[model samples]
Target: MTTAIIKPQWSPLTIALMVMGFIIFWPLGLAVLGYILWGEKFGGSPEKAQAYWNKGKAWCSSNAPRHHRNHWNRSSGMSSSGNAAFDDYRAEQLKRLDEERARLDAEIDAFHEYMANLNKAKDREEFDRFMNERRGSRQGYDQNKPDNGDNNNGWGSNNA
Candidate 1:
């Protein structure tokens, strides 16, 4: 006597609910679809659910890449492989890689600063050209104006 409305079977009610879930929110729809496909494996029990989770976890760990699997050991530097020579070699390589990464980071910073300076110079050049053109236009306009000392501000007076 399970009270769950959504079962793993492809009944009309389940299909309708799945479609409605998708229409409302896509992730909800995807969840419903997942339940429809794999609900029987969980079996509506806590122990079954836990077992399923553990199985998936084991699969993921087993399928991970070699470097990823050894990431913790490499990063912590506390694990030894029982070979002194190999350990020394690995330490030396890691140190060299760190130094190289530092050098590259410094170069990247220098390049960014150079680009910023170049952009500033270009903007300054454009601004100087604009100012010069503006000054030239104002000078030309002033030179073309009549020198007659009338205070009408560029508009001629109607009184002759």
Candidate 2:
């Protein structure tokens, strides 16, 4: 029988190292803290756990029926529940649902496109109106400006 070398596993030196690790590097501190808190789960021999897990997985895999395994392996969406009429009806229903989904997706895409076009047209109209207003105001200012000829002081100055 092999005796354990470390007595009183949570030694003061280990706690100090953990605290120092935390002060120096936060991740190291967190790792040390986790090891301190849940240290028991990591120990008690890894070979025993692996052996038990392998046995359980083998039992589960062996117990499953070949038909169920084949059904799972196949990528076909169709599954026969031992009734031909029901299978036919189920397949028809799935096909109809798929068609309806495709039609709905198309309609959604068309609606989005229509909304985008409507927004674009509205923006263009607003921009055109703004440009027209700017041009008209500039023309009005030019027309109201005083003539630069002689005796035209621009504030209605009478030279008489």
Flag clash pairs in model 1: none
User: Quick one: how many clashes does candidate 1 have?
Assistant: 0
Off by over 4 Å in 1: 1-55, 62-68, 146-148, 152-160
lDDT of 1 by residue, 1-160 (tens): 5567667878998888899999999999898898889888999899999999999999998999987878867677647767999989988998999999999999999999999999999999999999999999999999998887878887878586
Best by TM-score: 1
lDDT of 2 by residue, 49-155 (tens): 57666888999899999988877864375556888998899888888999999999999999999999999999999999999999999999989988879565666
Model 2, 86: alpha-carbon shift in Å?
Answer: 1.4
Root-mean-square deviation per candidate = 5.7, 10.3
- What's the CA error at residue 81 for candidate 1, in Å? 1.8
Over 4 Å off in model 2, which ranges? 1-76, 146-160
lDDT of each: 0.89, 0.78
